[model samples]
Target chain A: MADKVLMKGNQAIAEAAVQANCEFYAGYPITPQNEIPEYMSKRMYDLGRVFIQSESELAAINMVFGASAAGARAMTSSSSPGISLKQEGISYIAAAELPCVIVNMVRGGPGLGNISGAQSDYFQSTRGGGHGDYRLIVLAPSSVQEAYDLTMNAFDLADIYRNPVMILGDGYLGQMIEPLELKEYKKPANLPAKDWALTGCKGRKPHVVKTLYLIPPELLIKHNIHLQEKYGRIKKEFCLYEEAETKDAELIIVAYGIAARVCKGAVLKARKEGIKVGLLRPITLWPFPEKIISDLADKAKRFLVVEMSMGQMVDDVRLAVNGKKPVEFFGNAGGWMPSSDMILDKIKELKL
Target chain B: MAAIGTAEIVHAVNRGENLTFIFVNNAVYGMTGGQMAPTTMLGQKTTTTPYGRETKEAGYPLRVSEMLATLDGACYIERCAVNNAANVIKTKKAIKKAFQNQIDKKGFSIVEVLSQCPTNWGVTPIKSNEYIEKEMMKIFPLGVLKDKGN
Candidate 1:
């Protein structure tokens, strides 16, 4: 077994990315996520890899777009407000069908609220955070270990699906240190090369990889449907989640990221008190573990979704439950982290 | 080959090294329906600037070559108008120098070419060439704005 070293979530993500041989990284410095680019600056330069401290979030994502199209595993990282600026280039990355990884170590915000972890970006990360009809493989990491593991998975998933993959971590997760095994994971055998890359052709016809479908409505329609089909394949193959006491629990606490960790402790405490409370931690927030919740709703009495936002994922839980079970939400915003005690209080209040 | 956003070029060069840039400045947004560009001439009338770009409302034309020349990282920066054969020869030389600087690992180099947009300018090809000589040069002077080591 590989020995584990204590590491921050942000630094773990950077280490995992380099281990995965993602040779290009372009990013601007932002709060709570600065360690990512800072770590990359050193490691990438030591190995003679391409690393550009891009002008802004806009330039950073575009540089990622250029590098990914040029057949390099490339990425960028930012926090909440910065990610808003990246939405345009992210949309272009999707429209061009370029594979890359993006990380958002989220902070509290409608706009630059504070430099602390918050899960309000759930809607933005899971929903189409950019213009145009597209989807990102949004992976939410609950701890430093998952941060490292998912960062590697994100690269493979992006290349396998020919789509962007986002590793959504919060500020608390980025700053906290935990023991993580830096293992050399194997690449999936079925993953292939980027044959559609914009590498210059020497003996063959020059290839053009662009998103401009000006004429012929059917052409754009075909492209849109093709992307949807790819997303469908991803949904079928990559619906990931973790379960605890879901089989016989009366109330299942739905959460993800750090929010889920707090919920887990509360679930344990509630179970010791003879209450049948458990957790459903979603690993992939996009291909959202819908069937599991739907199936659990058939047997569970209720759901209590605790989050760090004003009740966003509660909507998804409600949709999954679909009136079969009562759904309730308790959240804290603007960097006010919810504690296990708060979640346990909510559990006691639910009395399911 | 087309003109890019000003910030995109300026910041990329300002932050990076060993890069080459060829900036095509036609004094207008040429292909995108003749709108105003950051390099649009002071009094030029375009689709957006119908009132000839009032100074109080719209700022003066941005001299991107001169602007980027101030940075220490910019190893070379030159502007040349290709309106005639003599200027075309000079533009070619400037273009070669910029690429050579990158090959020599001489930091960032940019060559801004003063091009003519005949259709967008609403003039004949000959008149458009003359326009660069008569109008564009007054605002955007043709010279080596900066060279770290001439």
Candidate 2:
């Protein structure tokens, strides 16, 4: 094991992205997530990699689009409002089926709400955050270590699927500091070469990366059907989550990201008081751990979902439980965070 | 050229990115059925402007080359026309120069070409060429607006 070093979560993500061999980075400044682009600017330059403090979030994502099309592992980072601006380009990238990583250190928002940790972007991120039927593999990291590890793995997953991957963090997760063991990034075995990338054709036929399929009306339909099949495979193969003390528990609290950390603390307090409570922390927000939750539904008496938004993930939780068990929710939005005591109080109210 | 992506033009120039932008100015929204565009000339008739375009309703024509020329990061900026064979050759040369500037890492280079759009302009193709030489050239002059590389 390597020696542990203390670092901020945002810096951990940036450094891990560098270790993942991200060749290009472009971003516009936004609060809570600015440290990522700031660190990437200096590090990428020193390493003689391409870095651009793009004109806007739109430009930044478009730059990522261009680099990914040209067979470079590219990345971009932003917050809520900035992420909204990149949606158009994100849709284009998804339609083109290019591989890249996008980081969203979420802050409060209906619009520029405030710069504080919030999980309000869950619906936006998991549901494709753009004008398309495509999906991004979204990873939610609760701790600095997980932030580092997941960011590194995100690149491999992107390349393997030839799709976009999103590292979904919050303001607290981005700014929080913790000791993390910096693991050396080893490339995963057998990632397919980006043969479809638009490098200029010398002898081989030219490859075109475009979204318009207007020749036959069914052309777009066929493309969309292919995309849906890819998504179905990802859903079947990749679903990551952590189960803590759930065996023979009466209440299982489902949570992710910063909210999950709080739930963990609450679950500990409940256990100390002789309450049979457990925690289910989802790491992958999309292709969400639906099967485990559905299986847990058989044993657990009820499930409580905690979040920093007004009950977004709870919908998925309900779908998974499917009336087999009672599913409940507790959440806040637009810059308010949940505490352990508040979550514990909510747990007690359930009378488990 | 459309008014969209104008912010990026200035942003890329300011960053001194080694990129080439070929701006085509046809004076109307050709694909969308002859609507008013930012570069639409004064008194030009389009779908949006049923009568002659008035200054109160629309604004003066935007000279993109002249606007970008003032930026210090711009290594080259030129406006040319492809109305005639000789002018077409000049436009090609301008485009080639812009790409060469990018290759030399000279910074942002742009070549704005005044093109003909007979469908949107409601004129014959020959009349469209004449329109570029006569009316469009008056607003968008043919020359190098900025050329630090030169």
Candidate 3:
């Protein structure tokens, strides 16, 4: 058994990244996630790793792009506003197919939102925050334990998929303190060699990484098709979810990240009162666990979608359920958390 | 390499220890079908600025090496024109020195080359070279902006 140590959520993710053998980390300081860059700043130098507190989020993401192009596990993290600034760079990384981990500890806002926890960036992270037909593998962590585990796994997943993978968390998920069972950093399953990396072309042909394919429009379309095929494969193979007491329930609640954590409590409370309720938590937000939701739609009479936003993931839930079941939404915004009472109230509001 | 914002370049110059940057300046957005760039000369006519850029409208061309030379971490900052045969030799020497500085681990260095963009400037290649030797040289003079070793 690995020794357990209590640590801040943000600090745990930073430590987990370090354990993942992250060769490079570049980030600009942003709220709730500042501890990540701070922890990396202190430890990376001693550990012979590269850490740069970049001038801005844009610069940080591009630096990660350059490092990742040179064949290293690189990462950059920011909050909502900072992540917004990194969108252009993220698009470039996606266009070039550079593998890197991007962490966004979501805080409130459409613009310059406050530095409190919020899940308002669900669509931003899942539905191509940047321009173009792109998809990032988005992971939602409900606890500090998942934060550590996901941060570590994010590096591997980023490499395996050769695309950016995001750890979509809120401020609370990054600030909460909890004991975590440390796992040894293992290399990702079936990570291919980065032979296409820009390694100076010393022994092979020079590798060029760019999004500009202008001489022939057809070439750009072909590149886009290639990327789309990869995304399709990801959708088919990399969907993950966790079901709690959903086997025999007639009514189910769907939530993710911290909302799920709080909603689970509400589901248990509803069960004790003889209300048939269960919870479905989607770990991977991009490949939104539609299979389970659609399958449960066959048995469950109603679905209550919970979020810390203005009804973002519910669109996907509705798409998955395909009108077979009544899909309802309960939202909270402006850094307000969805409490158990609120979720329970919403369940009762469904009147099933 | 054709057109880049100065923000990222400034940070890279000041923060990165051993990186050699070759900044090719053609005074216009050459790759983007000759749109006006931040480094377009005061009176240069780009596609975006069809009436010839005005001081009130477009400001002035940025001397990138001079701006970067202000940073303490910038080891070498040279602006050379590659217009004529003799100038080409000097420009090559400057580029070699920039790369050598990185290998020597001296510090960050950038060699801003005043090259010609014939297609974007809507001129013959020969005429573009002459433009670099004449118009471009006045706004962006060929000289070393900063050198830590010297």
Candidate 4:
């Protein structure tokens, strides 16, 4: 029998991490997401797991990088400003193909914006916040259950892809409490001994895991091509989305994360008023359900892109639709969350 | 003999098994253009500061050693200087103590090596050392803020 308990989103994620056999957690405390590190500090300390209250976000992510490189299931989390600070290290993690989970309980952005729920980091997460031709397996969780489940899945996806996976949540999602059936904790499989870990050579060959390939232009290009191939494979196999009331719908709303939750309410209310509204929530924002959106574009006359950021995901919607349907965007930025009523009004205004 | 500061401190901390941190309180950035750092002195001047740093305009430089002292992980925290050979020896002792603390797995340790940034001070290194001995020491008194005593 699954153990059901009421837990805050942040606590759920922390618990899920422990269940997933994450042995190392290094992070600095930030608002709207402090519960994660705080919980980890107490729980992990009791469990004799390594937890470091890192000096800075830079230090925290790098510590995670080190632990993950050493073949430990490691995680670090932060809000917007801290996540911005971690971009450089995140890029390093991706380049080295190290598996690690990064949770961004996103707040307002562009600067030290605010401690409010915002999806402004959609582009930052999916498009690779740092400089690179790489993509993180970005998972957007819309509910507290997902906050727990996705965090567990994040470790698996990260290990499977050997790429960084982000559990993108908003401040509201982080703060909200919900009932969750906790999954059984499974010990991670023994990782094949890799030469690259910093463990003592112990009479084995020395290993180097570095992204600096300054030898030749052709060699660097070939490495990039190989990474691209991996990304291509991920795009095909890992793309996921949830469709709500798509059959016989004229207007399809495309949203993700908390915004999707709001859109669902709006869609339901609009349905009661005789508006044929449906929702398409992209679960994996990077391997964005482009094919699904393209197929919907054929039947849906109008598409509305809703987000907490000002139309960041709209670009992707436009690309997916490819002018097959009229795409409209509505959003609130810098920590402002649009209410379900406002979203309903927008859908009504679009008059599909 | 050689001296080190934040750059050397971070490098050593990252590389060495048991390490210490030494911070200098010259009240200036002391590097490219001497603007201000987290530890810039309250009233100091540099190329960027035509007038002395106004308390209202620019905030005071933080005592980094004291900050590190508060961390539960940190073991020993002390502030010392190299204004004179006697004080330099004292600073050396503090650095050794910090390293010893870490070697004992006591915790993270730091030693503030309050020295002078003469180039940014617009003075000779000798004059800067003298200024540090006379002025800076008065503001940032040297002592062990935290000691795990391991």
Candidate 5:
């Protein structure tokens, strides 16, 4: 039987990564997400996993990138500001198509915004936050259990896609505690023959994985096109979302991560008030649930988008709605969280 | 020691090794109270050239990523601004890419992060970011210069 345990979202993610056989963890401590590295430092050391408190977020991410490229399951976690210090490495991993898991316990931002919860990074997480024509499989976990499950699955998806996977949550989710079930652990298969990885070439012909194409512009274009195809395939196959009361909902609430949790409460309140509101929570943020939103547009008359940031995800929702329904945005920036009553007021004001 | 030139970059790429180069472009020797660096922007005021960096006197801010991207071995090269929130996000992406490039064993990667030296710039952290945005980004626009395998 699966054992139930109460754990903070950050701790659950750390444990889940360990159970997934992640042997390498490199990161700098940052607010809300500090518990993750703090827990991993003690646990991974005992487990003989390589855990390093890096000099900076830059060094930590690079270390994890190096280990992961060597076919090791590796991970790193940081807050919004620290995560900003890591985009260079993230873009490189995306370009090289290496498998690694990165967690961003987002905080308020737009400088040193605040140490509070905010989803302002929605655009950065889903829309190739890093440079180049690359994409990360961004997963948004709404609960502690989901945080654990999504982190475990993030490694698998990174391997499956041969790309970096981002577990994007906010300070709320990172700091919150909830009941969780420790899932059975399994080791990743011997990394599929990756000739590109750097493992001191001994027997095999030396392999080089690089983004530099000193070749003709034509060649670079071809490489970019190839990456686009891969992204298209991912969009087709990896769009994960949950629909709550969407079937009979006249008003669909689209939210993600911690915002989704708040939306749930709002939905419940709205239901009691006789408002037919539903919830569309995105589990996979990158290959966003555009199709579901589009489908919902056909059935629902209104869509309300909520987030901790100042209307970042609202643009995506508008694109999905395509003017079929009125898509309204309700948000607070700089770590401010919307209460259930506040969201309910928005729903009432919108008359959705 | 490896000579600092194009040859070093080429050699690293041919061998498929990861290298990180942190280029501090303060336009002037910031530690020495704002003297000009090789990457100092033209017409910019530095302690060394308080009259403002004249085109003839200070030359131009070396667009490091642009030159580095020309190398075959460089996998990821980007210029980032570290002074503010919007720029901070861009800078973090650049940093992550540089590290990821090294780990992926995809040749050499470099991040030229524009940082503020309040003491040298004769300003506060707030004004430093403003100076970077208003003055620095004009010369070194933030973006990825080279992305081959990514």
Candidate 6:
């Protein structure tokens, strides 16, 4: 095993990004996710990388856009409300097909609800939080170690697709402390070169990175078609999830991020009590492991979708199940998290 | 280019980023049919402000360069007009200086060019230039508001 270091979730994500050779970072200070920018400011400064504590969330996302266009790996992060402010820029980055990482350490929301961890941004992250027909490769990490690992991989995923990748976390995941192995950084093999990046037109024609496609309505439609094709390829090639004892279980719990961690414990208790319950945790929220859930729906008698938000991921679960079996929901919101006993009680109530 | 992003301007100035902002102030919205913009002159009439912009109703015109000049991080801020040949030359010089400041790694620089929107202002192009020289200049004075390098 590599040398293990105890670290907070946010700091691990920051350190992982730095290790991934992320050269530019710009962000505004928002609760729950503030440690990411705070850590990046110091680490990036020492490494002589560009780090701007930008004036606003809007400015931060735009700065990330400029840096990414200049062929540097750039990143920005914010909490729920701040992420809302960044949607317009995110849409532009998506339309331009610029690769960048955006971490949304989701807090309780609707509007400045609280600074605690919550999974309410699931729909927003998966359904293209911005205004457009686009999607972000959303990765949800359930633990501090997964947070570090996923954040490290997020940069490569962003580059691979020429699309923005989102690290969707809740406040608890952002603030949690756990032991993490500091793995050696290895650049993935045969990653595509950024030929589209704007590195100044020296001995070549200029490359214009813009989202605007005016004149001739077909031009915009053509661009949209290209984006949709890329998304289809991603959906087919990359769909990740974790399954635990799902083979013979009659009841399954579908969850992700912190909610999945709690359900893991509940699943164990249900098993100990001689009840057949299992867990399916989706790691990639956008390229959501729908096929696996659909396949499991045939075997399992029923499923329970749990989240820290008020029934957001449940919609995705229901869509994946598609009436093959009954899908129930267990959720809490506004900084409250479900306990294992609470989930066990729900399982018993379902008479599984 | 437009005053709709005033918050972004404030943010950039505060960070002292080595960037140039070319602010083209046409006083009124040109697209989606003319409407009053932040830089619209007091008592100016537009599609939205058909009764002429009243101080009580519309507030004062935003002097963006002056507002940004107050930030310590702003290295240079100048407002110019391209209404005539001599002023056009001056506007070009100011723009070059702003870019030069960026190359020299001097912090935030902005050059506000008070322009004319003839179509939106309901006037001929030549008449719009005259309005910029005769009326617009009275509210948005053309000169260097701040120059930290000098």
Question: What lDDT does candidate 6 reach at residue B102?
Answer: 93
Using DockQ as the measure, the top candidate is 4
Q: TM-score, each model?
A: 0.72, 0.72, 0.71, 0.72, 0.70, 0.72
Question: Can you list the residue pairs that collide in candidate 1?
Answer: none
- Writing each residue's lDDT as its tens digit, candidate 5 over B43-93 gives 666533445555553355656568667767677777777777887787677
Quote model 4's TM-score for chain B. Answer: 0.78
Evaluate model 1: give its TM-score: 0.72
- Report, to 2 decimal places, the DockQ of model 1: 0.02
Please give, for residues A1-352, the per-residue lDDT of candidate 4 as tens digits: 8989998888999999998989999876677787787677668767878766555678889999999988899999999889998999999999998899999999987788888889989889988899988889999989888889889988888888789999999899999999999988664584344446767767887667788888778877887899899999999888889999988889999999988998999999999999999999999898889999999999999999998988898999999999998999898798888788999999889867
In the range B1-150, model 2's lDDT, one tens digit per residue, is 235567867788888789999998998767635656678888887654555555663567888778888889889999999999999999999999999998888889989999998997899999999999889999898998989996
What pairs collide in candidate 2?
none
Q: Mind giving the per-residue lDDT tens digits that candidate 1 earns over B37-110? A: 66778777765455465455346787888888888778899999899999999999999999999888888988
What do the candidate models score in CA lDDT, each in turn?
Answer: 0.86, 0.90, 0.86, 0.81, 0.81, 0.89
True contacts kept of 5: 0.00
TM-score of chain A considered alone, across all candidate predictions: 0.99, 0.99, 0.98, 0.96, 0.96, 0.99
Please provide, for model 4 over B1-150, each residue's C-alpha lDDT reduced to its tens digit, 9 standing for 90 to 100. 011133444444434335555555666545423544445555665433334544543346556666555555556778888888999899888888877777776656777788778777878989988888777777677888877665
Query: Root-mean-square deviation of each candidate, in angstroms?
Result: 16.9, 17.1, 17.4, 14.6, 15.8, 16.9
Model 2: CA > 4 A from native: B1-150
Clashes of 5: 32
lDDT of 3 by residue, A143-245 (tens): 9989999998899888888999999999998889998988788886698888788988776778998889997789999999999999999999898888998
CA displacement after TM-score superposition, residue A209 of candidate 5 (Å): 1.8
B51: Cα error in model 6, Å: 55
In model 6 chain A, which range of ten residues has the least summed lDDT? Answer: A48-57
